[model samples]
Target: MGTFQIEGGHSLQGDIRPQGAKNEALQILCAVLLTPEEVVIENIPDIRDVNKLIGILGNLGVKVKKLAAGKYSFQSDDLDLDYLESELFKQEGSSLRGSIMIVGPLLARFGKGYIPRPGGDKIGRRRLDTHFEGFIKLGADFRYNREERFYGVEAPNGLRGTYMLLDQASVTGTANIVMAAVMAKGTTTIYNAACEPYLQQLCKMLNRMGANISGIGSNLLVIEGVESLGGCNHRVLPDMIEIGSWIGLAAMTRSSITIKDVSWDDLGLIPDTFRKLGIQLERRGDDIFIPSMESYEIQSDMDGSILTISDAPWPGFTPDLLSIVLVVCTQARGSVLIHQKMFESRLFFVDKLIDMGAKIILCDPHRATVIGHDFHSQLKATTMVSPDIRAGISLLIAALSAKGTSAIHNIEQIDRGYERIDERLRAIGAKIERID
Candidate 1:
């Protein structure tokens, strides 16, 4: 296992370019399966999750060629659907939550799809009910095998579009259904759909491939099914998750950092959430400049009550960034309630924060009340093992802001999403080193 040894209390100052969105890249990669022609994808992040998904595509006989750095051409004309049942496929597919999206396209094109229980951050009960429900609405039959822990779906009559409302605005769930509906036989109306930038990109790509879709950036999406999809080139948007992490990192260490090429429009509710903690940010065109602040305070409600920041579906504060926000709030001057409504185990990471000398009360698995120390009483750094991608980054931010040296183990977890994080942070004046 590798670990990052970081000496804290250093202010990061530099212009760092954001990597491509990991979430968007994964869905777009899988969307390539809907066409047999070569689809060129650019600005893809070189991260563990994206690499693993590419491996999965290769196992399925998709011809994946890297033409240049951060650019890939995928042609699935010879893709073998039988590999979906292979042991290697099952093992790799179970490692990522995004793998569940393959089901929609595989079933739509090949008439059947098989996947083991998809694995991802153990934040909470990320249910597949919404996915299965969407498939069933599109005329697919699902069967779950408890003993093998695999889920299979088939649509004998092909997918026929139908009106459906998602139980919740699950990001992956919405992507899955959108992929399926694009090739259905009739008009598909999806209500309460996830309208995140990632989903918008997926819709735009599908539309470029001749799939008729309307309401690209709203909760209501209408798709007129196309018989087939053609290939097209797509460039991914900048990673907002990385932007949020960097914002938190700068705030915790009182650093002045500039994030370049960030999609300011796609960063819905993110800047506002950071503003709640009094982190001053200035937007110069597409770049975000986080100025070093002498003091940061949690903005309370109009009635003078402690502010509550929680996660909801799309266009709301993303649940993925809750861990980072929780860590950032620790260095703020006041108290804030962090409600991680979507995930049960996400807020449990606060114990590590508490150990770092921050005052935090874990109300339950879903909520925590954090009282900031404003870095007046610096946390003495120690060894910590990362748990998940978001939590891993959160711990890294905490370690960077703490005093003394901290050894962060399981850095691979962080690498699953963020690309060359140590290198990026080092360029920005952070004192961090990766050691095996």
Candidate 2:
């Protein structure tokens, strides 16, 4: 295991570019399977989970080439269908949650998709019901092997488009259903779909490759079946979650950091959510400039009640960012309640913060009340293990803002999402070193 030894209270000052969107990359990379043509994608983040998916594709006989840094082309000309039943495939497919998305494109093109239990952050009950139910609605056979703990979907008769009203706005489920419906025989309408920038980008990319899809930025999507798809070049948007993390880090350590080429329009409700905690940031054309501040205070409601920050679907605060918001609020001027509705286990990481002298009340698995220290009291260094991706980054931000040095083990969780985080943060004058 590796650990990050971070010396806190250092003011980071530099221009740091956010890596490409990890969530979108997961979705977009899987979309390459919908066609046999060469789909060239740029700005692909080099991270563990992503690389694992790419390896899985290579094992499946997809020609993945690295054209340049963060640029690659994939051609699924000779997919190895039997490989899906191999033990190697099961071992690899179980390591990343993104593997679940490949099922859609496989079932759409090859009439079958198989996956071992997908592995990802243990934040909450991330069910595969929405995905399987959507596929069943679109004329696929779904089955689960209890002993092997595997999922399979097949449509020997071929997929036929149909209407599906999702139980909730599931990002992966929406992407899966879209990929499957693109090759269906008739029209497909998906209501209450996830309309995040990630899904929008997927739809746009598919359309470029000859899939007829409409309503890119809304909950409802309409897809007209296409015979086949060709390759297209796609560049993913900036990682909004990473951008939000940078914003929180800047506020916690009172640093001046400029994030370049951030797709501001795609960052729905992210900037304004940070502003709620009194973080001052300005947009310089396409860049976001967070200046060193003397003080930042949290904003309350109009009725003077303590503000409540909660996560919702698109155009609302993202659940992935609530961890960062909770960490940043620890140093704010007022108290706020954080409701992480999507995931039950995410808020449990705040106990590490409480150990470091922050005043936090863990109301339940989903809610927490944080009374800010407002820079009057500083977090003391402590040792902790990273639990998940978002929570891991949150702890890193807290460690950087603490008074002494903190050691965070299980940094592999952080590495799964953020690319070379310690190295990148060190470039921005942060005193963080990766130790094995």
Candidate 3:
């Protein structure tokens, strides 16, 4: 394991070009299994999750080639279904939640699929019932082994499209069913679908591959199944999560940083969410520029009441950024409630923030009330280990703005999402060093 020793109280000042979206890249990579032709993906982030997904593909007999830095070419002409039963496949496949998406394409093309229980940040009970419900609705027979903790599905007659409404707006569930529906026999109408930017990109890419899909940016998606899809080159969009992390880092360190290659149009409600905490960001052409301000104050309601920033489905504040928002709220001038509705355990990391001298109240498993410091008193640095990706970045931001040195262990978790995070922060004048 590696650790980041950061000398805090340094302002970050430089230009950062955001990498490709890890979420989008993983889905697109799995979509390669929908066809046997070569698909080239550009701007793929060199992160651990991406690499792990690529390994899964290769182990399943898909040909994945790294054509260039942040570029990959994948061809799944000879997919080996038996690989899914291997121990190596089971172990690595369950390591990330994104791995569950592979079940859709595998079932679509091969008429059957098996996946072990998917693992990710232990935030809450992330049930696969929605995904299984979608699969069964599409003509798949599902079964589970309690002892083995493995899920299996068989579509002997192939999948036929149907109209279905998801119980909730599950992002990965939406992506999984969408991929399955693209190759079904008839039409699939998905209501209450997740229409996040990553899903939009997936839909656009499927369209480019000859699948017919409508309602690209709305909750309702209509997909007309096709016999097969062709290969096409698609460029993943810039990482919005990284953009939010950088925004928090800049605000916490009182730094001026310009994040280039940001897709302002795809940033739905992110800027407004930051603005709620009085972090003003300006858009220059396509980039988001955060300037150094003397202090940031939380925006109150018209009745002079404290505002709550909460997460919902798409077009709402993203749950992934709530940790970063909590860290940013610590530097703001007033109090704000950071409600992480999607994940029950995500707010558990606020105790670490409290250890750093931030006033936080963990009201429940899903909510935290943060009282900002306004930089009136400096936060004391302390050694901590990263629990998950978002929490890791949040702790790093808090460390960067603290009064002394802090050591962050388990950096591998941070590297799973953010690409070359330490190097990137160093470029922006952050005094962070990596030690093995």
lDDT of 3: 0.92
lDDT of 3 by residue, 66-145 (tens): 88999889999998888999898879988977899999998998899899998987678889999999999999999998
Q: Which one is best on lDDT?
A: 2
The per-model lDDT (C-alpha) reads: 0.91, 0.94, 0.92
- Candidate order (lDDT): 2, 3, 1
What lDDT is reached at residue 125 by model 3? Answer: 84
Where does candidate 3 clash, by residue pair? Answer: none
- Least lDDT summed over 10 consecutive residues: which range in candidate 2? 342-351
Candidate 1's residue-wise lDDT over 1-436, tens digit each?
A: 8999999988889899989999999999999999999999999999999999999999899999999989999999998887888898889999988899999888888888889998988777889999999999899998999998999999988999899989888888999999988989999999999999999999999999889999999999999998999999999999999999989988888889999989898999999999988999999999999998877989999999999999987788898899999999888899999998888898777788788898999998888999989778887798899988999999999999999999999999999999999998898898999999
RMSD in Å for candidate 1, one decimal? Answer: 1.0
In the range 1-436, model 2's lDDT, one tens digit per residue, is 9999999999999999999999999999999999999999999999999999999999999999999999999999999999999999999999899999999999999999999999899898889999999999999999999999999999999999899999989999999999999999999999999999999999999999999999999999999999999999999888999999999999999999999989999998999888888999899999999999867899999999999999999988899999999999899999999999998888888889999999999999999999999999988999999999999999999999999999999999999999999889999999999999
Total clashes for model 2:
0
Which residue pairs clash in candidate 2? none
